[model samples]
Structure formats: C-alpha cells, structure tokens
Target: MNKRVLRIYFLISIVGLLAVYFFWPKYEKLPILETVSSFQLENVHGGTYSLNNEKIKLVTFFYTHCPDICPMTMMDLMKLQAQLQKEGIFGNKVELVAISLDPENDTPKVIKRYSEGFSADPLGWKWLRGSEGDTKEIANSLKMQYQKLEGDFFSHSTTMFLLDDENNIRALYDMAISDNPIDTTKILEDISILIEGY
Candidate 1:
C-alpha cells in the first residue's frame, strides 16, 4: 500500500480502538477463589445461624471489643447498607454478616449491643458468634487472621469478603489498616455491580 493509504488506515484503526475503549460497557468480573458452604454459628439473638449459598453475602470478622478497626469497619458497612437500601438492593439481593473473632468474649448479648450501637439493621445484617475453635476455623477458611492480646484484647486483620449467591468468594475489601481508612464507596460500587448481575 502507498504510505498515504497506510497512514490513513492507521488513523482509522486508532480511532476505532479508542471508540471501543471509551464507549464499551464494562462489567467487572471478580474471580471466584473458593466456595464457602459449611459454617454454623449463633446470631445475636442466640439463634442458630448457618452459612449457605442462598444469597450474595458480605462477610467480615470483628470482635465486639476491637478498639478501632472492628467498629470502623462495621460503621463503614453500615453506611454501605444504607446506600444499598436506598437503591433497594439491601435484603433481596445482598446480606451482610459480621462474625465475632473473639467469640469467647463476644457473646450473643455483646454482639447485639455492639451491632445496635452501629444502628445495624438486624433484618438485613447479622452479628454472629460461636465456639472459639469453630470461629477460628471459619476465619481460617476465609483467610482472615486474629490473635489474642493482653486482657481481653485481640489483634486482627480488617477485611471484608464478598460471596456470590453460590457462596463463592468473589472479592475482598481491606476495609481498614493501621494507618488508612477503608474505601467504602468503591466496595459499594463493586457490590452494586454484583447486585446488578443478579
């Protein structure tokens, strides 16, 4: 081809590529790490709670007494829940589960009190506690770590995991760390996309 013709074709190709990149509808697909199917625990009401594949779930580990991250994480999720509710996607499409890492100290009553302090909607969110061994196993399966500290204190990672309707781990949010605040908006945007898929 002539140089002029080749240059024209290259320009057209670049425009086409830019159009596709800019105008295409992008749906983010989160990879499935593993299926979470087996877990039984006690809810804040002291009722039996089980994890299954029925609903898209947001799971996080926290202890009622966590000095900072735990409360901040849940409060952030509280805002997320409110946003989802405003969009009418809170309960029918998604649910949130906050599991107590210090189950020995975070009894059903303490879980209830802590959740209420955050104004958590119990109908849409659940606070859970179980035996220390069972809770550790559950955390292990989710790849979250927590260690006992001095005098009813604990050190734990701050992570929130998103599970699909089939109970597959789809995404995770590091809600908080030692020095940074959690990005709840991005997490909610991702959850909105997932809910849209359902």
Candidate 2:
C-alpha cells in the first residue's frame, strides 16, 4: 500500500478505538450473585426487620465484641454512610445492615450501643440480631461463615454483600484488607448504578 493510504488507515483505526473506549458503557448492570430468602430479625431499636425489601442494601455480619475486623468494617461503612447521607440517599434509596454473628450475647441493648458507637443512624443503618438458628440460616444462605472462639469472641467472614432492590446479591466486598478494607468508591458507583436501573 502507498505510504499516504497506510497513514490514513492508521489514523482511522486510532480514532475508532478512542471512540469505543470513551463511549462504551462504563457501568453495566451488576450481575446477580444470589437471591437471598427473606428472613426477619430483631431490630436494635424495637420491631422486627425483614431482609426482603425494595431498597438497595449493604449487608455484613459482625458481633459487637469483635476486636478488629468487625469494628474496622463498621468504620469503613461509616465513611460510606456519610457520603450516602450527603447525597440524600442514605435511607431513601440505600440502606446498610449489620447482622450479629454472636446473637446470644449481642442483644438488642448491646447492638444498640455498638450502632451508636459507630454513629450508625437507625433510619439508614440497621443492627439486627436473631436466634442462633435463624442467624445461622441466614448466614449460611449468604455464604458467610462464623465459628465461636472463646469468651464471646468469634471468627467470621470479613465479606460484605451488596444487594439490589429485589433481594438479589449483586456484589461482594472484602473487609479484611489491612491497607484498603472496603472500596467505597467502587461501592458508591455500584449503588448508583443499581439505583439508576443500570
């Protein structure tokens, strides 16, 4: 081919690639990981709360006595909560749930205190505890594993789940990373995608 023709073709190819890169869908619909069955647990404030809902939810399993991962996760979530609240979607479109793994000891009162310590507003953040059997049932369904250690301590999964409005698990986030526990930026994007029906 002539040099001029080759140069023109290369320029066209570069422009096309740039167009695709810039105009392609950045955030596609998040895949549904699993559909969680509805389960009711005692809310920290008072009445029972069910997982089946129309609002986007971020759910994590933790115990009040957790020395490291649980509290750290809550702190990370607190940051997210502030951002969501600032955006005015904290309770309306998105909500957070922290279910107690040590249900026996994490009573309503204890969970309430824990929630307050993190400044977890009940309107947007729910602290839930149920019977041992119920807790295991829901945790197993969500694939969250936990085992009691000693003296109110327990080893548990450090994963948090993001669920769509239809109760489908959309994404899982790691809370065990020492340097970067939760990717709140990605999470906020995912939540926005879900809210916007993308």
Candidate 3:
C-alpha cells in the first residue's frame, strides 16, 4: 500500500481502538451484601432443602394465606420462573425458593397446593416451610421483618434476595421500598448478570 493509504489506515485503527475503549458497553456486577450460611428448610414435597453451593438462588418469603402482597410476589416469581427456563438457566444456574412466614398454617399440603396454583415447577422452584423460629431467623438474616396482625394477617417486608452458589448474599431487591415496584425484567437482568459471573 502507498504511504498515504497506510497512514489513513493507521489513523482509522487508532480511532477504532479509542471508540472501543471509551464506548463499549460494560456490565457492573451486582454488589455482594454478605455471606450466607446454608440453612435447612422443608420443601413442600417433604424433602430437606438448603442453599447448596451449586446454583444461584432467588429467595423470598411468603405465606399461603397472605391477603395480597405475598401472592403478588409469588406470581411475579412464577413469571420469573418462566423467564429463567426460557433463558435455559432455571435449574442449572438458577433456582427459586419461597419460604413461608406462617409455617403453622402453611403446612406442606397447603404449600403444595399453593405451589400448584401457580404451576411452579418442582425442579426449578421450591416452596419451603420451617419452624416459626427458623423462618424468622432466615428472615432476620436477610434483613427482612414481619409481624402478626390481629386479623390473622402478617405484615412483612417484601424484600427479595439473591444468593450465589456459595450461599453468599449477593444483592437484595426490596419490592416495598419503591413507589414504582421493581419489575420482573430488572430482576431477571440482575440474575443474568450474576449467572454470567459464574
């Protein structure tokens, strides 16, 4: 090539390099909040459940008889389950767990029925229940709060947590903290980012 052509090509290469360096999209990873210990809970199927060091977990709390928010949260998660399966990350890289706050009423049978009402897949999603103290302990560790109301309803924090394979608390998405609720897309995006990290 001629000297003029070579010089133009060199300038173009430098410009391309600069563009890539300055303009390429970057994904900021979700922040790790704290390390989580594997706590045991009972799945609706009468099997033991824990956050094993193998999959990313989307953990939330709910009760079978919750008037509104709990059901809304699980419905949102059912949508999320579909999205995760469509993305081919449902079982391999991601799992969902909804722990019951009212274990006394949310027996395995009740929770199983609840899980079925939403078409929750047992392989990808699990509805869990533990003793009242254990459930409270897990909630407290995730910085969630709950109270039993006089009307047999529980007022609780609707905070969703993301945990890595090692059971570390990676990120929290509080559905109650926002005037505009956090949509499922954003939650899936965060999960995608976390999965990509692994």
Candidate 4:
C-alpha cells in the first residue's frame, strides 16, 4: 500500500511540474508585438488595398515580373490559405491582401487573371495596385524597400506581414523561396495566434 501511494505521489508531481513548465507565468508574460497602422498598396492584378481597416489582414508585397522569389512567395501564401481553410476560419475571420510593386505591368486585368490562376476560389483575397508614389510610401512605412532592377526583373523580399484592423503590423514571415523554405505547419500555428479576437 505504501509503495502504491508513493508511485501515485511521484506521478502527480511529474504532471504538476510539466504543467508548470509548459504554462509558466514567464511564458505568458511575454508582451504582444506592436503593429503599424495606415498603409496603402496595390495588388498584382491591380486594385486598391488599404491597411488597418478593422480586420485581421495578411499583406505581402511582390511584383509579377519577378523571376524567382515572387512565385515562391505567392505559393507559400496560397498554401497558408489552404491550411487555414482546413481550419475553417481564415477567410471570414482574416483578410488576405496582396500588393504589387510592378504597377506598370500588374494591372487590374492582370491581377484578376492572376487570382484566377492562383486559386480557382480565391476567397477573402484582395489584389492591390495604386499610384507609384502612394505605393512607395506604404511600402517604406512597413520597412519594405524595393527598387526597379534592369530589364523586367526586380528584387524584393519574399516576406509577408500580418496587419491588425488599426493598421499595425502584428506579425511577419518569410514564405517559401527556392533558397529558404519555412515550415508550413509552424507558419499556420503562428498565424492562428494573431487571429485571436479578430
């Protein structure tokens, strides 16, 4: 009887310690990251997209003419959308915004066609394009810098941003590129965290 009682005590202690370790106050105390407000962007097919408009939005900047990084970036976001749809909360609860840096080439027609190509049913997706100066200001505000390269090629980040309804940048991610690939499961997990109270 004493041995059984001691074993029970040990098991309870182990469980308690695990609970403490996993759900520590210190872990909970880590502050939420701040986000930026009020930005504007244009999508690959050409449409107006504004940030911080009272929704949980995922925004990314890319140019259609991009030979390498842009395609990989879009694939990552599309994959993310698929994962979120499986969860059944991404489209209605979150906004997916894509902005294009190559305004000259990425017109509204192009964006529409692009969306069709990207997904048969592109739910909660907004492709944006605007005046070059306006787009520049928005991109600069987000600390995303880009410049036109020679020919039709451009260099830009494959990273995406999460913005709150109030125009704050809540989270950022490097979507899959040929050189670097992030874990899709982990990316979905992080996005789920920002989706709270949205």
Candidate 5:
C-alpha cells in the first residue's frame, strides 16, 4: 500500500511539471528576417530620429489623415504602449516608431496633434515625417507599399514590423485583420524573448 501511494504521488508530480512546461508562455528566439536600412527623420518633437539604436523597435507606417486602417493601428499601438510602460521597458528597452507616408500633409504640427490624440508618449513612441522621397525609401525597404489617393487619402499596406536591438527585422504582424488587428500578447512575448537575449 505504501509503495502504491508513493508511485501515485510521483506520477502526479511528473504530470504537473509536464503541464507547466507545455502550457506556460514560451517565447522562441525570433529569426532575423533582414537588416533594416538606416534612415533618419524628423520627430514630432522637433528632434531628429534615427533607426540606429540599441533598443527593440516596433515600426509602422501611417498618415495623419488616414480614414480607417491607420487610426485603428494607432489605437492598438496605444494599448501596447501602455503594456510596455507598465512593464517598465517602454522608452528604455523598447520603442515604437510610426513613420508618415504623407510627409507633405503630416507636418510636425499635424503629426504632433495626431500623436496626442492617441496619447502616444514621445519618450517611447516617435511620430516621424520626412521628405516624400526619403519616406518612400524607408517604406520600400520595409516592403510597405503606399499610393496617394485623391484628396489626402492613401492606399497602403497595413503591416507592422518588429525589429531587434540591432535593427534586424525580426517579425511582421498584420494590422489589417478586422477581427484581431494586433496581437499584443504575442508581441509582448516576443519582446520578452528579445529582452531575455534568447
């Protein structure tokens, strides 16, 4: 009877350990898709922002006057910004970049107001605008296509990029899905993997 009880307890312990290992959040080391081309643009705060940095970055492209997709993406990012802030990594270990596709219209003042509308913190979230040619160059490198439509509108790709500290494109997340625009939980897990140097 004593031996049977000990075996049963050992089996239960093994099952519990296996459950934890399989069910607990696991962050795999993300692959380096490609190195991003270094670019510099004007931040909304009147400062120059560069892609060369020693911090993880989430990069997206948008225009202040975007009708639907851009605004929705920003909303999702605002939620992500809060999570990163709560984790105490925002602005320090991780940064968010939103580059303007409509640089002509998204001037410093315009972009600043847009950022404010989303409650984007300048310390961690950067709203950048540059010349049309420069903006196209960066967008092309990221495989983000955009075409100007009539009267302050654009048809653009709704993809968000995740970059490691070394400016390597690590992952791409879709922002066009209506049901789930951004997977904050998955992003946070990936960020943790990068932060842990996995």
Candidate 6:
C-alpha cells in the first residue's frame, strides 16, 4: 500500500491494541454497588433483614414457579452453601439470601415451604420477599432483569451475587449454563482474598 495508508493502518492498530488492553473486563470487581441502599425484606422464616448489616452473603433472585432455570440455579447455590458449611462459616458469617421474583405468589408461607424443599436451614439460608414494586426497584438497581412468561411464569438471568459485610456486590456468579456452574471454589478463594485485603 501507499506510505500514508500504511501509517494510518499502524496508528489504528496501536489505538485498537491500547483500547483492548485498557478496556478489558476486570477479574476482580472494585465494588460496583458501592452506595446502594441497604435493602430490607421479610424472610420466609418471618424475620426482617437489611443487607447493610448482614454478614458476608450470597444473594440470588428466583421465583417459586421457575421450573427449569431457577431450580438449577438454587442447586448450585446450595452446593456452594454446602462447601462453605464444610469449611465452617455456615452459621457464623455466611448467609444465602434467595429473593423471589414472583412476589405475588411467593409469600412468606410459600417461601418457607420452598426453602424447606431446597433443604434450606433457617439459621443459614433465607427465602426472602418484598412487595412487587419493592422487588422490581431492587432488581433494577442490581441489573437483575426479568420478564413474566405465560401462566405467570418468569424468564430471568441466573446470577448469584456475592456481597461482603459492607453490602457491596463483590462477585457475580453466573450459573445458567450447565457446563459452567457458579465456581464455589473460586468464590471461596475470592472471599479469602477480600478478607485478607481488608
């Protein structure tokens, strides 16, 4: 090609490389929801909670009627809980809060029953809910979008976010695909890393 064209191409290549290098996705998050309000909800066990004062926790969203996707996601969460329990903070510092997407149907009673089905322990895990508007606002803030399907079903992403003691979303665990479940091992690794960092 011509000299001018070659120089332009080289400049573009350098710019592209710089963009890719600088704009790459970060492996470690720097507290995205740094100042989000401390959310309040009623637990299936009939207790009140706010994320601000809660311990280090795993938080996920699901509905009682979600047959395929949510159930799988819950199983993965349970596995992570189990792993955490085996390591000993199952009761002291670790908590799993699964918020309901279907607030209309997932009342305190329904959430309690659902938690039972998932082998949820009241001391460690919670099936939580709030008003429809309240849930929508919280989900929007977290970027956990969902849409109602036919027969009042729902389609939503299967992501469990880990929150530290400060209520920041420390890690996002995407567990929709079967081949790649939430990395409990990595999550635990991060928890330790963060704890050390603090």
Weakest ten-residue segment in model 1 by summed lDDT:
45-54
* Candidate 6, pairs of clashing residues: none
- The whole-model C-alpha lDDT of candidate 6 against the native structure comes to 0.79
Please write out the lDDT profile of model 3 over residues 47-160, one tens digit for every residue: 798777489998888888787777767777788889998999897789988889998888898889889988899998988888999988888888889998886689888788
Full candidate order by TM-score, most accurate first: 2, 5, 3, 1, 6, 4
lDDT tens digits, residue span 72-147, model 1: 7777788888987897867777888888888777878778888888888876787888888998889888888889
Off by over 4 Å in 3: 1-28, 176-182
**Scored by Cα lDDT, where does model 2 land?**
0.90
lDDT of 4 by residue, 2-117 (tens): 99999999999999999998787543221345656576565444344556457677777877777667667677667777877778866577767777787888877876787666
Off by over 4 Å in 5: 1-28
Q: Write one digit per residue (lDDT tens) for candidate 2, span 58-155.
A: 99999988888888889999999999999999988899988998878888888898898889989989889999999999999998998999698998
Q: Over the stretch 96-157, how does candidate 6's per-residue lDDT look in tens digits?
A: 88889998988788778777777777777877889989999988878888898889799887
Model 2, position 12, has a per-residue lDDT of 100
TM-score of each: 0.81, 0.85, 0.81, 0.74, 0.84, 0.78
Clashing pairs in 1: none
Kindly list the per-residue Cα lDDT of model 5 for residues 64-170, writing each as its tens digit. 88878888889999999999999999999999999999988888999999999999999999999999999999998998899998998999888899999999999
How large is the C-alpha RMSD of every model relative to the true structure?
4.4, 4.3, 4.6, 5.3, 5.7, 8.7
Higher-scoring candidate on TM-score, 1 or 5 = 5
Residue 142, candidate 5: C-alpha displacement in angstroms: 0.8
Model 4 accuracy (lDDT, Cα): 0.70
Which residue runs of candidate 6 sit more than 4 Å off their true CA positions? 1-33
Q: Name the candidate, 3 or 4, with the larger lDDT value.
A: 3
Best-matching candidate per lDDT: 5
